[model samples]
Target chain A: MSGVRKLVLLGTGLIGGSFALALKRARLVQHVVGVGRNATNLERALDLNVIDEASHDAAAAVAGADLVLLGTPVGQMGALMQQIAPVLAADCIVTDGGSTKQDVSALFRQHLPRHLSHCVPGHPIAGSDLSGAAAAQYGLFEGRRVVLTPFAETAQNALEQVQTLWQQCGARVYTMTPEQHDGIFAAVSHVPHLLAFAYMNAVLAKVDAQPCLDFAATGFRDFTRIAGSHPEMWRDIAVANREAILADLKACASQLQHVIALVEAGNTEGMEDYFATASRARVAWGQRHK
Target chain B: MSGVRKLVLLGTGLIGGSFALALKRARLVQHVVGVGRNATNLERALDLNVIDEASHDAAAAVAGADLVLLGTPVGQMGALMQQIAPVLAADCIVTDGGSTKQDVSALFRQHLPRHLSHCVPGHPIAGSDLSGAAAAQYGLFEGRRVVLTPFAETAQNALEQVQTLWQQCGARVYTMTPEQHDGIFAAVSHVPHLLAFAYMNAVLAKVDAQPCLDFAATGFRDFTRIAGSHPEMWRDIAVANREAILADLKACASQLQHVIALVEAGNTEGMEDYFATASRARVAWGQRHK
Candidate 1:
């Protein structure tokens, strides 16, 4: 496959900068352009050699680029797509690193309707507590899973190009529909984060919240680690994928209600049974994953 | 302070075996007697040098012992306490390593009424997935917190002796009422565990559970790590600490309900505010603890 002549990153944070670095290391892209509102971050990306050039204007950056990666938060992707639509080349392959696919897919359809054939909405499952261009590294996507959700109008050649690029970055790629991608993420990532936030809030509501926190050990630490995630990013996820997230939250609430009933009735056998099912499945999953 | 002449362990598992090993390393105990129902486990304890002697009979083992540690599940502690009550030495310092203290306090009151002055209930916060005598380590409690709940009738010297021994084992000891210990633990350890179990079960209830599990990444792994805990052990804790666990679980459920409402109403700012509170507090706690 021919390498990208010019690759543009719409937002040069960890995700976009890391992608640029990885592709640069693989020699799959000739020149990289990073576009973001943060001048300091763009300067850091240039200092770190994550991108060859930096630009504040998205439209100008992608004017003649063969590849464009929308690595900003989902909330910012629509305006970015609208800004670059008029200046994009005839076949500039546009993809994104959004956490949610359905929303990004809708944005592609809304702002870049004529460019659907070249747009591939994707999510790279490399979540981290760190951000900014300084957090980017060449191996960030190595061994990570990336899910691509291509709409019906997306060209097969465009999809293959994105997949091959992610492969060059040492990522394992899988393809699914936008709806399937949203639902699966809602189950595994989105809902667990929301649950952790809720659990933390509940602990805070306690009369002895400080003492309770003081006594919290490893179990509490690992369980609520995600509760310390970026508030704006999670708020976007919680609202953007509202229907899927609400369904899982309701299911979790119902499960808690069942647990309460069992505890109230002093049902040792039932409680053991409930816990055993979860423990057994979790243990099996852990062994397999490990 | 003088060392214990002979110490009896009524349950020779991780907690009990680790305590025996720590005391031996400190040269604070002249003799350690491990007693349990499983002959194989007792033999393993002896082979591992975690115990100086092994016995199948708790009553027989405590006949001439100056100290006794009930290092078993809460459900089995009562039976062992009753069995050793008639044989216990007059001034033997009896303590337990149970997770929940209120029930153990009640058991000490009922089974060893005459020995209340010598009884000090303790909980070592060194939880691990591994168990059995082989899993015992020399410094399992080196930097762990050990909470001791000594009743009003407990002799100062007896409590001091237990506290001193734990200090020798390299544990930081804190004293509180049994009720306070249970409530604080329910908020931190017990409820987080129960919440994890409920979350795992909710995931298992999904129609595409396997696919969800396949796609589960780091967040799910950390969030549900405690769900793989021992079922019978957690069941006993849930029942023994029923009132406090139920209250926290209800509060957690209510929090989830509020989150659901925020999502349903598309209240992005409300969601952001709710997440910010938790994220800020958790981040602060992490920094302080680290």
Candidate 2:
């Protein structure tokens, strides 16, 4: 129930900026320090009152902070962790908004072994196509789910504090091992993005791709929505969670092969049942979610 | 252009019902007769003024009709065509809202051989998850594209009538051979639906599928939106456009294999480029279309 005396966001982009703003609005944070290599984005965060101060030096920004959020892409988190480890207060609680968790867990063990108890690796399921500080809003995490993949050495008090912070932001917090979180996300989020990208390439490979795209309608719009995601970020995610994502991708490829065989053989009954199983499940899922 | 004197809908669902409403709004048709196995749905069409009369007999419905629009699953088209062929007027036009065209072209040749000159196969890209007569709306095809695949034997006058009728419904009409229309749709629409179904089945095969589904977010929602489509309808489309759909499915499988190799080798640069190609194109497409 103790408030953060100084909160630091190592990457003041959408996720980081929104978290800082939410905590500030909740009166749970006294001072927010925005740290990023993007000077303009960091300045925007400060101008938008998402942070009380802005700094390019992540190491210096966490010097006196009670809570520090590593909100950058997972690929950038390791170096930031190493830089801040030397300056971090002994009692400071560390958390992240990374999409993947196992790699971040490894980074925690490798760079901040002594601070494992203070590190709470989290993934807030609140991503949008928009990014950077300007995309930050006051309620980005409202009614969203935040998953914490806390390692074995994570302190109970640190975990509770991180959970409470997310709950204060109107996010429902769930805890799982880094492995479970990675596998689940690989199946649901990462695999779908990869398939969408693959499907887009399939269309592009066509000789009449331009005309086909011109004639594409609403169905194509929804199917390829994720294919339009940020490439660098997705590439990093695919590689970071390589094993789990690879497994899911292979599963998808195998399913696709089966579909190809059914279509090639003109197996109407089999194809119909196959399509029906997935179709029925998807409709059920949509209704349940609605 | 002369309007339809007595328009008959062979299957008064979304497509048929909507066309009737649009024609009624444009005052292009004198009377609209709705025909379907579902008496309740036909009654709804009449109640909504989507039709002036309801009939369960396809042959009886087409007896005095100057224009008969078959708007049911492609699988049901053959039976309805056979039923109405005996009663169709010599000068009457036969059209359809089937998604696939090649099979309907074949059906026109097989069951309604004498009426081939009057048969105008069309595909209105005005699909929605909601079907039934109650889902009919006058603006369903407003600004949408409707493709008409007229056979070699299709009369020029009949073609013009169908084209003019669609234009009056606020749809831009394009004419192509059934082969060309099937190829384009297989690449864009049919293949994507199959891929989404495959992706859904892949997720279902995972050990922690329930948890994966539970954690699925917006990316998953948009990616699988097409997977929730009508199973029987897609099955008919897949089987009807078997050759083209098969070719596209194999093309997609090949693309998936390439992606697997890229990820399996941890080819970050290749994967990034692959994703960037799709992302850039999709964004450009979104901008251009907007």
Candidate 3:
């Protein structure tokens, strides 16, 4: 812990930039170096004070850093890991800020060096609709949940170090299996995004549709906000976690069918009861969580 | 407009309560008299300064007020209007905070006295998941939309007065027909709520479901928060606006079927394009609106 001075952040977009800022705010990292494909974005990160320095060279950026954090889209993790694997120091700890965990873990296991016992896969359940380094802000992870899914072979010391870092960033860390993390997120996050995307597409496809954009109230905005996220990133998430996403979709489909049947049958009381229960559950959960 | 002093706010819950607070904050209304069934809520309204006074008698509340605003659930508006119809002054302006417009308009035409030419039916396109007078807060209407659906018979002066009042309360007002308002809201608000309710219900009904609540992330929380809204209110909105609600549901259903077909056919490219277009449209719409 005493020797952990330099930190290298891969993909200096929202997540990476936020991580860099949080670390700096907490004074956990002595120097934060940002790595990204976009040189302009790296410069913007510097201007925004998201990182101490910007570097386009991935391998060189990870060369002597004590901690390396991957904040790339889920799809790019494999290639980025492979590119940095050769240059990464054996004792340097690596973590991620991806949405899905299973694929990222698989990629690390496949590409990362055997001596890199410090490679720990993680996902912070924190984000916004805004993208890029400019959207980053200090304390973005404060009071947010950060889930770390470590493999059985992952070194205890490495896990502890990553967990401690997230704690210092003001995130409450939870540990779960990669499978559990994927399944839960599919039900809660991925499926919701899919539904929003699908719904928006449907609304748009209607030729004579009214000006939905003009008439869209706050409810519509809130429901569709996640639909505005990076399509390629979401596409990767959908394909990578296909089975779990499908399961959640099927569950949603069945529920919709049930409600449709009741509506068709004129079962007003039944429909009311169903909605009432959902409303009560949501209110209670929100109150308790908030 | 100068003589419009006393304001009677019926059903002092979320919309009505917030309106009262906004009016008081802006000093637009000299006195806001709240009328509702719940004595505790009415007392809380007075205690929280959402209303200047409380009255259990709807007729008494409307007797001296220059502006009468119905803030009850849409289904209850007709009955409440009937209860106060005889006591309503000829010169008083009557409006509503209901979501759907057609039923309320029909109810007003039927039950309201013909001498009361000042009846202007309106729907404030803003609210939160929280209900009751205690949840009311100032600035709820800031930069939000309020739709006023005035019939041909509606008095022009009355409409202008109501529009000015809403403007003073910090809302941009739009004009539309009752049918148009209902149709647009069905697509934007009612259908979205149904989807949320149906989605959450489906997750809960899963036979081998994991602990979804424990793992529910911000996405789930945001998407389902409206599901926790007042069941009775939503039930009323859905049933009263059944035709438009069904139309919106069919639209969403057709879109879902298309996605399912593409997924089943292994048309990955088509699915990706579908999602991408939707994502792009939503991102553009959100940016503009925000």
Candidate 4:
């Protein structure tokens, strides 16, 4: 436990609220201030004991805090960072719970240039379709991974503090460069979401789509599960991480083209080998995970 | 209860094994002859009581069978149909559990022209990563959907018998033409498996694939779950349903191209609308399903 006396949470929803609850259970956090745009949500977080107090003004909330966590959408982090810049304590350490890191790193650079060493960029890989402070729970981060991408200017002590906090929240922490993090996540996460969306749109284009969907079984259900993601959030992530996502999508297109040619030419052997490679790899991958 | 005197299963694997177990529990099947190439799997089926007898010869197995189920891969079904043709009795009803119906329909026409009325082509939408006779369960098809694609020459009595057997296994049976079954499944089932294969292959093409796989969470898990499917099985389905699957693949490629254009142009609102279209439809589909 970091023994942090005062901690402020910006955008007290699932991630932030859950963090507060975990640390409170550890007896590490004495006072927590929840800041959010939605007054109803802030009140709920307070009522649910996700925070000791609630405030709409982020800058005012961070006034006497030793630690401040920015848990809003990547799109909203810049404004929040700009708001809390002047009022943050001299030694206050600021970290975030954003999915994408490169843009958040850029935001930190732009908004708090003078507070560079105190700003530690981190992402806790715990997101669900469910949202709101009411969805927060103590064990949300249990056995989950948290990736921290700290810059050269990021103070060693500040990084460790945030790392310790995540550890106390039952998460294993791993550190990587922002570029590597974005590239890896683009291949695995962002690109899959885009493909699922595109696949859903393709099905909707068919004349007999309703019948197709009605007869769809478990495979269709699992493959398109992420296609029902929040549009605004996915759109923001897509636009925010445009370059890496475009590269991933282009790779996917290239592969799809090869597959299309094989199918069009009726190359049974080539198609079999192709499907075999993927299936073997996936089965091997699952075995490793298990 | 059909009280099938002797039911012969051509391939005693997941689908066939489970069906046998379900029928045994229902007391609808008096005896089940499990036929497969693998001796160990046959012994396991017998030990598990999924079948009362085990045999390697398809022709020998069907000699006394009142009901014969061709439960092998679509690629192997034609040969099995040929093997059982000479031995099948005039009153014996023949059905299959192939994923694609048109090819199986063709096999029925080619190998059993004289017995067309007694042949029924069916696809039970129950698939899992687990295989072998040991994975069989009594309730595998309970509350599951079974599509029966009866031909124009199919006898009403034969279709009803097969339908009642599925109902006894606790499945809801649906009737359609073989072409309709192929088209709908091509759009939903076949295409999604191919897409998942393509996506997994794309990730493998990346330089940091293992790292990407390492960091992948729930979204990636569900998205790529079917990628771990049986390679030979999927290849057979893909090639067997090539025409319909090709059309679906083309539509998906077109949708991906459109998404790429939206993303490349950085048209935020356009991208949002595109994502929203897919997200809305998926959510609505899920709601209707629930």
Top model by DockQ, which number?
Answer: 1
Residue-wise C-alpha lDDT for candidate 2, range A1-290, written one tens digit per residue: 98899999988888999998899899999999999888888788878999889998988888889999998888899999999989999999999999999899999999999999999999999877667899899988988899998878899999999999999999999999988999999999998888888889889989999989999998888888888888888988988999998888889989988998887787889988999899989998898776
lDDT of each: 0.92, 0.90, 0.83, 0.89
Best candidate (score: TM-score): 4
TM-scores, in order shown? 0.94, 0.95, 0.92, 0.96
Model 2 ranges with Cα > 4 A deviation: A2-5, A43-49
Sorted by TM-score (best first), the order is 4, 2, 1, 3
**Every model's DockQ:** 0.84, 0.81, 0.58, 0.80
* lDDT string, candidate 1, B182-276, tens digits: 99999999999999999999999999999999989888999999999889889999999999999999999899999999999999999999999
Q: List interface RMSDs for the candidates, in order.
A: 0.6, 0.9, 1.7, 0.9
Model 4: residues with Cα > 4 Å off, grouped in runs: none
Candidate 3 lDDT by residue in tens digits, B53-99: 99988988898889988998887888888888888878888999998
Q: How would you class the docking of model 4?
A: high
lDDT of 4: 0.89
For DockQ, candidate 1 versus 4, the one ahead is: 1
With a 3 Å backbone cut-off (N, CA, C), the pairs that clash in candidate 4 are none
In terms of lDDT, which candidate is stronger, 1 or 4?
A: 1
